[model samples]
Target: MTCLICGTPYQSTPTWSKLFLNQLDSSTCTRCFEKFEVSESTIDFTDFLGTPYEGAVDSVFCLYTYNEPMKEFLHQYKFLQDVALAKVFAGNLQQAFQTREGIIVPIPMHPEKLELRTFAQVDELLNAAQVSYQQLLVKTKSETQGKKTKMERLETSNLFEAMSNIEATNYILFDDIYTTGATIHHAAKILKDAGAKRVDAITLIKG
Candidate 1:
């Protein structure tokens, strides 16, 4: 009935699944949504080959690229604290995780940052997708990764600690973005060290 991004009312043609499954509807308008680009497969992690982070993550699946549209979207969703934007990708995200066979675990925000951001963006994405996930790890450090160089990020001390007992099963690490691979690697390494059988990752974007 209405596009979430542009605010101009638009008609969403009915589909079979929309009629039967009570699924989430498109929150983004065709014009705005088309501006966003879906990326290809996993990002380049060849730099980690000989590093301690090698094999820390089995694979990474990214849904979108950090294109201009995505850049704008993230600004509104995270920095501007528009929680509703999380629903824009709900249906797509649900479909992505439908075939994965691991326990979903979203990367957590630090307490202070969570207070500032008002909501956990990563968790909100999963919730908007109606995907169940466990909060197994807690962020112990709050250093901003945006300013750090690739090597600086890789060499930084671990930022997470397990908040609960991690079962020795495969776990899917979910995050909002994959930048230098530091956050995912640190989180995955923590899970691996805590005895998770396998750790793979999925992100909303590949930066």
Candidate 2:
């Protein structure tokens, strides 16, 4: 098989998990996959501390740290519209979610941005991983959060509105990346306010 990220041909090795557990293997080869650094840094919630949104999110689980290879991967998959690249991290994402319990909810993109991007990048990740998820929130603000400063981002309000009545159940929010975490917090707050018992997040890259 050809490594999805580096385009180098490599062999896929079968293991106990693949043979018995039916675990899906990542599309990228071992060498290219190793370029994504595993993230161990804990996410801080001080930005929402002391606010109504304090404790909105229970915890955040990040798989990879932002790096050069991941940067290039995001550029090609998200901006260049390479939908197939979503499968690159399928094994990693699936394994992470298996140990967690919740109603998987993917963060929704703004309608305008989705139109421009031609796809919901976050949802595509879940689809590629074969993870079941619900669309529970709608992005309200149309402006991109990337251009905003940290304070400005935290100050941005009503970023998401609940799509339906949220049950008093645990929810796992999925996203493509976690930066200042404003986006994830906003979505979590809305769900919590709408009656979700607990909210946690899983992000592809910790930027």
Candidate 3:
């Protein structure tokens, strides 16, 4: 098999070992895996975007730093539509987050963007990690955040809305990357307003 990130060929291993490793490997070679800068601290949204709405997201857990390698990985996986590359982070996510009773809600994609991308990148990440989630939120706007300035992005709230009545008191929001903290805060505000008692978030990288 080939390494997903670097395209390096996997060294030959015993049949038994290969079978065992295949079940756990994320298609990332050891060298490439070592290159990733694992996050050693928790992220505070208030530090980036000031205080969030009352009773919004409590905290955010990020897995890695959004360095150049991670940026390239996301560009390939999301923009280039390399679907299979989702597996490269599946094992890492599963290890970072264990299943819990609360709902796992992936950050929603705008309908128009969804039509173009074919799938939500966060949803694909959760699927590859074998994590179950609910599609409770929907993007109300189609404007891409990449085009917006920092001030505009921060001011651009109300981008997401709950699709229906939410009964869950606890929720875990999932996303591929955290940039200005606007997206997660806005999404979590809607969840909290819909009766979520405590909302937390997890992201693959903090940009």
Candidate 4:
């Protein structure tokens, strides 16, 4: 098989060592795996919002930098619909951090976009990692973030809405990428307004 991120060929034979390492490496070749630079910093949500939002996201734990390899991987996994590539980050995500008793909420996709894409990328990542999550939020707007400019993305409003009353106090919002922080911030606001006490987020890449 080929490395998911770099496309370098490697042995796919099942063995004890390979199986043990696969749990940690997600089948990525050694060189490509080493290329993923782990983030030691966090993004503050308040920086993106012009005015302070009530119950804003506390912090975001991003895993990888939006480097060329990660960019190509995301484009293929998300845009090109290479669903199997979701496994590439599953191991990293599962080990990113521990959550204090709360539901893992994936940033919601609008029904129209879901119909076209046939899957939510974040949900697929959690699934590959065997992490349980709740689809508690929904995107009210059908707009795609990739086409929007920085200002437009930041100024966009009412993009997300809570589906129902959540009994959980803490929620971990998951997404594929964090570009301007608009998407996760808006989603966290909705969750907070719906009675979520604290909202934290995790993204595969910090662009």
Candidate 5:
């Protein structure tokens, strides 16, 4: 089989396949898995205006920017309901966090919206990443922020809550898009309030 992340050729055990089987419908070759590897240079978390996070203590990582292959990739995963793509996305993330240890939290979605989608896209991607993480945040049932302006998004849109004590000093926040800084800002805020030393936010795209 091939490595799904880096596209490196190698043999994979059935047990390993079973671990990530739920992430993908079919097993990925060792090479493809290796090629999709997530690295520090690959991780990007810049805002539209090219601004980084405030008091950024640690590095923020993102698999793909909102462009080209990344744009197409995310579009397929988000709108096309391409479940397999979720595995690749998650695998990339898993590789990114292999060395770092901490809680990996996905941006929460409203329960009503979650019901409509029938799944949390961020959660699915993180699951594919194959890293240990927790669903610590829950979106308060609030208005959708898509139609809102940047300030409005920052002002409204309930995105996160502390599910447990923030024991992990190194925390990473994951999301599909980095349109505005609002969503992640809220998540980081919640994590910090829970006693996390640092909160790093990442997104697939920055636009």
Candidate 6:
């Protein structure tokens, strides 16, 4: 098979360990991937209600707009048990951040959610990207952001806390999806309050 991103034919051997197999065939050619670059698109950060705010995340960098194979990949990564897809998704993010040097932080999941899912997809992606990451933000309590409207989500956005021993540094917040900026905004706010010089966000898909 050929890699859509890199056009490389699949190697006979797999890159992942024996127990960690990929659902999608791995055939990305070296050349196709080499041409890809990570970049930040110009996006305005606003609360769910379209209320713009300063000091919300400075920028949001997405690898792809929510579409096609990427969308299916995300669906599998988030809902189904297709954890391997997280690695491919993270590869795009890694390419986007090739020139960046900072602590990569995942947006984080509540303990209950983490316990239910057994993993944070963003965390898995960061690990797959081979990037140095710190779990800087912690969700103190369970608040269902999925059910709320944009403004409602923004209004009750005091959900995260900066973990202890997280040194202030240039950091990027990572997540799987970007719908309204509410979650990223709150996560960035905590990092900024904790003294991160600049807080930028990177997501696999933008909605």
**Steric overlap count per candidate:** 0, 0, 0, 0, 31, 8
Quote each prediction's TM-score: 0.95, 0.96, 0.86, 0.85, 0.69, 0.76
Task: Summarize candidate 5's per-residue lDDT along 1-207 as a digit string, tens digits.
Answer: 554334566665556644764333224565443433333344333432332224432555655545454555566667777666676655445556665666777888888877777778888877766666788888885676788887566555346667777774878888787655677777787777677887877666565
Which whole-number lDDT from 0 to 100 does residue 132 have in model 5? 65
User: Which residue pairs does candidate 6 place in steric collision?
Assistant: 3-28, 6-32, 6-33, 7-29, 8-28, 8-29, 38-96, 48-150
Which run of 10 residues does model 5 get worst, by summed lDDT? 48-57
Best by lDDT: 2
Against the unseen true structure, what C-alpha lDDT does each candidate score? 0.89, 0.90, 0.81, 0.78, 0.63, 0.68
| Candidate 6 local lDDT, 74-192, one digit each (tens) | 66667885676555644445565666767788888898998888778878887777677787789986977789886677777478988875556778888887877778888877877
Q: Candidate 3: give its CA RMSD in angstroms.
A: 3.2
Task: Please identify model 5 stretches exceeding 4 Å from their true place.
Answer: 1-58
**Residue by residue across 86-176, what tens digits does model 2's lDDT show?**
9988887989899999999998988999999999999988898899998888888898787888788877777999888899999999999
TM-score of 4: 0.85
TM-score of 6: 0.76
> Model 2's lDDT to the true fold?
0.90
Candidate number of the best TM-score: 2
Q: Write the per-residue lDDT of candidate 1 for residues 1-207, one digit (tens) a residue.
A: 678788988878677876776567768778988988998856787878877788889889999999998999999999999999999999878878887889999999999999998999999999999999999999999989888888888888899999999888999999999988889999999989888899989999999
Once fitted onto the true fold, the runs of candidate 1 whose alpha carbons sit more than 4 angstroms away are 17-23
Residue 76 CA error for candidate 1 (Å)?
0.6
Off by over 4 Å in 6: 1-41, 46-53, 165-168
Better of 4 and 6 by lDDT: 4
Better of 2 and 3 by lDDT: 2
Worst 10 residues of 2 by lDDT: 45-54
For model 3, the superposed segments whose C-alpha errors exceed 4 Å read 11-23, 47-54, 99-101, 149-151
Q: After superposition, how far is residue 187 of candidate 6 from its true place, in Å?
A: 0.5
